[model samples]
Target: MKTLRAFITMVALVVVGYLAWNGYIEPEPDGDSTAKPTATAAPPVKPAKGVTVTSFRQASRLLKVIPEDRQAYLRSYFGKGWIDADKDCRDTRQEVLARDSLVPVSKGCRIYLGKWLSYYDNKTWTKSFQVQIDHLVPLAEAWDSGAYQWTKATRIRFANDLKEKRGLVPTTTSLNYDKLADDPQWYIPKVNKCKYIASWIAVKARWSMTVDQREKDAIDRVMKGCPDRKLTITRAKIGLLPFAAGTGTSNRNVTIDSIVYSGRSEKIILRNTGSSPAKLIGWVVRDEIGYGQYRMPKTVIPAGGTLTILSSEGRKRLDAAGNPVQHANWGDVWNNSGDTATLIDGKRKVADICRYTGDNSGKARC
Candidate 1:
């Protein structure tokens, strides 16, 4: 009887224990749950550093093929006339005149009397007044190509570009008017037809400008018949005209890239999207409200590089080279809700402006 009782008690105990274990069950404690898993963030993709083309054929191919972005391109959209980047009295016209003239500037940055050979008509010119400074890629054509999307400051630069030798030419007023905004296909120069086409392709490539099917076909047909030579082209968006105006040798385009409105790490970043260094000295950056003006120092932003302007402490800070970082105490100036940053040249002319509508992203690429 005692043995039977012990066996029965042990069985009862085992059943109770099993039931209790199942009733008060806990998870494996491996940190797994029914919640959805968080996603891993992706790394940022960098922009193209730039491009180097070996020939006119290659350069021509480099142009992005797109239809004309025809907005009623106003002449004023590109800003008034020329820029005196060097702060010299000579604006872009006189600068180009002084440059293209076979003789030195007749007087004080003026090209009153000089010798010039017009590549368009293949005629030599004597008086400066006889010839006008012509944009190889006319502004109208540029707007039709891709510049309609550019900023006012950029348009001003393009209109007054004296940086690249191929961009601006001294030509007779008659031919200048004749060419107007026509591409090589429509308006062919009596002399240097191939040369004109090459330059057109080059300018288009340099500025990252696009060509319509017709424009592309015209250049392609021209290239096939000519002896091909290597042509180095850059993709800076028609490389906005010149560094500090004409002194810039390479096609230089600068843009107001991003802005961080507040905090100790607040900053406004400007990037030289061009392949050449851009002179930023004497340039002014200001918020929409008048007092937030910060003048750029004597500095040049190298191609593909950046100029970061800090807030507050940046004013007294020195770079690694012992130069001032060129900054503004913009925390109080830049409104987090919405704001605008305008870049003006030494002449107090607007160069570029970046405007942002507030967002959670914490930075504005206006």
Candidate 2:
């Protein structure tokens, strides 16, 4: 009887050990397991640090230089209010709070307590209400630029755009109120001026919005101060709908327009042939050799617009030649002998490819 009992106990121990090894039961805090853990919600993506000079120059060139046309302000035109566009049961405001909060969210869409860093004033807040969601490009400003002509649906998307980080920012309430439809000339806390201007221009370019002469001049003046920074605006996939009639397709046709493989100024040029503006925010340019890829900065290519990307060394050389170099810098991009330059969009789709053979020759057949 003792032997049988001992044998049964041993079998039970083996079974338990197998189960534990296979993760049939939850392991203790320190135990290891082979089973994959269930996935949880991903953290919110942080906003881009600052845009490059190349991207800002491109966006500036595309901006319409006109006088501001004041229009009547109507909050109702944009939509009811903070919407749960993502179907996450949380409104846009709550989403922003949850994203910017230092502490984890407690209960159902409520961020009762958390820490927030305000970019506008470079202040930190412990209370939720102290921080307000700021529309980087105000609705009235959009209207003056051309959104007044947009459909009600489009206007709502622009107003409540949670897709692009630049579209909305969490700032101190006082600063939000103080910035009332003003251009970049308004105070943006000296430290954050570059990022602030980049976000402003990016939001405008992404939405195909225009800028008046004063707005353009202000942006240009600020950009002159940040010669090395570039602005690359990637298009937000969420909250955007199909273009209205005669607005053309949402697809942006970007191609590897040209490549300068040889000489002192080696660079790749891209062009948007589509009727709608193309956001090159997440696009990648690459070469076959070394498989080196250069991710584009957040920028927009207006219809029929062209963007030039130069290597870091090339940009420095060009800047020395008295020409204001507006080119995205990819370090040592091309092979002198021969290489292939390919353009890939945000969706991982191949947009265009250019190839060249380097016989120590001047310029590839791109």
Candidate 3:
């Protein structure tokens, strides 16, 4: 009987120890023991960089099909003349002069003495009048391509686009007149041929403008000689033009109006709902992963104006009335899903915030 009691005690102790080990040391099951395993979320994908011409052959292949529309070209269709689109009290021509002059501007919106390098003919000038603001792509060429079908507002915007660096250039007046309404078939100095062609391609592509057969052939021929040439085109959209009146503190209110996080063609729209113009010199747009900082040269937002920051790769979508939407280039800004965009002003104040999940279908939700 003693041996049987001892053996039973030993067995009980072993059973108790085993139970304690499982109860205290081992991991406990979830509330529902039969619950399925949770899935891990996949990593986000990065957007592709903007379209770049790797080679002349590639550029030739990518050229748009020649549009057969022989639209009537008229200067008035674009705009009455150079207007003060930026509302800086200086007209577009004066603004270009002020920006391109090597010397400091002397008078109000006038550059009496300055050095300007005209790339078209390898000439440099000191007199401001000697240099004419030449549109990289002429207005008539734009009409022949696709501008004829555009709304009046869109044409006006294209005609007086001071936002884009390549849109208008400071070249010798003689060169500007000689190359009037001519395509790439015209002569460009040997040194500037490559860049000239590239700029031409960039402007056409940015405006969604087409090329004629002759124009395409000319580009192809020029590019064939330049095998290693590469060109990247970036464009800025024009914001709303503020009215002359109400130049007060109330007009200085600027906000992050909208954001489009769709794939490569991401865009952020900023609006100045105030009565006075708001300067966005050191403004920043940040998403979860990356951010695009604005370094606008003349960073003034007119009252009731909207400034759109767009990605380089997005398709140029138009409004219902067929007016070309203006946008600035902000490459690969937002993620595909679960992203937050914050707009910070020069003073480091949060101007606006937009948060969304999943795809936005290229529309701004915030």
Q: For each candidate, what TM-score against the reference?
A: 0.51, 0.49, 0.49
Which ten contiguous residues of candidate 1 have the minimum total lDDT? 243-252
Q: How should the candidates be ordered by lDDT, best one leading? A: 1, 2, 3
Report the Cα lDDT for residue 285, model 2: 73
Worst 10 residues of 2 by lDDT: 241-250
For residues 27-137, what per-residue lDDT tens digits would candidate 1 score against the true structure?
344466765556888885544467575676766777788887454345766776677888888888888888888876666966688888888888888888889788898
Q: How accurate locally is residue 8 in candidate 2, as Cα lDDT from 0 to 100? A: 100
Which candidate model has the greater lDDT, 1 or 3? Answer: 1
Backbone clash count, each prediction separately: 4, 15, 8
Total clashes in model 3, counting residue pairs 3 or more apart in sequence or in different chains:
8
Tens-digit per-residue lDDT, 1-366, candidate 3: 999999999999888789878885444367777766677988855434553434545555555877534532458768899898767678888888888877777667655678888888879899888989999899988877867546568789898887666789999998888888887866555567877887788777767677888788788777767756555554424232121112212223777677766755677777778776666554556666543543222255666776766756333454454322444455666665667877765544576778887764766567
lDDT of 2 at 243: 27
- RMSD per prediction, one decimal? 28.1, 21.9, 26.5
